[model samples]
Target: MSHDLFLAAKAAMKNAHAPYSKFPVGAAIRTTDGRIFSGCNVEIASYPEGWCAETTALGHYVTGGGGEIAEIAVIAERMAKVTPCGGCRQRLAEFAPAEAKVYLCDDAGVVGTVTMGELLPYGFKGGILKK
Candidate 1:
């Protein structure tokens, strides 16, 4: 089932709109309810206005009424491994637990799997700010 998520991410990468960077990325997230959401990076002409694939997938999951991501997969080309960026890591933390599995993949397949906490230790939690 995890491998299936990676495959879905790879499929999504085909539709990435990265004309400028030429570095396409795809992301897939599996909710605790067993539903999977996939997304591709969409780059814009304006700088710093682009969205990461992980953010896109999270949006789809939230829009679909999903809660608590169990696992996530990120795939990209020409890299040893692909992981979510810092901003995306925080975005993912909003809907995923610290122990959620994060799969890093390349064109071949999954290269590694790390927990969300490993990706972003001491991540900013909304409750912390509320105090």
Candidate 2:
């Protein structure tokens, strides 16, 4: 909430590959160590083959040697207070704690905020996958 994730997400949104849907979105995730990873939506020719911005950011976060996620920020070119999709919510919940802040931003700045748990109250528990 106090970091530059809004700016980071806005910058990433400019690089989105969204020719098909023309809906460019961006996401930025912050690790507890203050590292920020940002990503943009990438759409392909196939309708459902494309991934969301949060997915790309998660990829970066994972490959960057993952840690506890502190917060997340998301923005869209045409929409304000844009939140992550369902799949992304689950993916984020895997790394981010229930208390982690999720910022919904517009072009200007963060307009709203929600915790990971609040956003996905009925989310599938990750512990079930542990063996």
Candidate 3:
């Protein structure tokens, strides 16, 4: 199951628009309801406007009526493991539980797996925004 998710991430990587960095990345997420969404990094001319693959995938999931990510997989570069960036980690923490599995992979295959909590300990939740 997760293997397939990783493959989806890899497939999405093919569509990345990273002309500047040349570091393409892809991300896939499986919802608790069993739906899957995948996205590739999109780099814009303005560097600050570029979006990470994980963030794009999450946007797709939400747009498609998915909620509560059961698991996620990220694939990038052939030689080294690439995990989601700090902002992506925070975005993921919003939908994934503390114990949700996050697979880190490269072109070869999955190199590591970590829980959402491991990536972002004490992540901010909705409670923090209550006024």
Q: Note the Cα lDDT for every prediction shown.
A: 0.90, 0.93, 0.89
Model 2, span 19-57: residue lDDT tens = 988999999999999999999999999876899999999
The model with the greater TM-score, 1 or 2, is 2
The predicted structure with the larger TM-score, 2 or 3, is: 2
Sorted by lDDT (best first), the order is 2, 1, 3
The TM-score ranking, best first, is 2, 1, 3
TM-score of each: 0.95, 0.96, 0.94
lDDT of 3 by residue, 1-131 (tens): 78989999999999999998888899999988888999999999998688999999999998999788889999986546788999999989988999899999977777899999999997899777988
Candidate 1 residue lDDT tens string, 50-80:
9999988988998999887899999986565
Cα-based lDDT at residue 28, candidate 2 = 96
| Top-lDDT candidate index | 2
Candidate 3 deviates by what RMSD? 1.2
lDDT of 3: 0.89
Candidate 3: pairs in clash: none
- By summed lDDT, which 10 consecutive residues of candidate 2 come out lowest? 1-10
lDDT of 3 at 123: 83
Give, for candidate 3, the lowest lDDT window spanning 10 residues.
Answer: 75-84
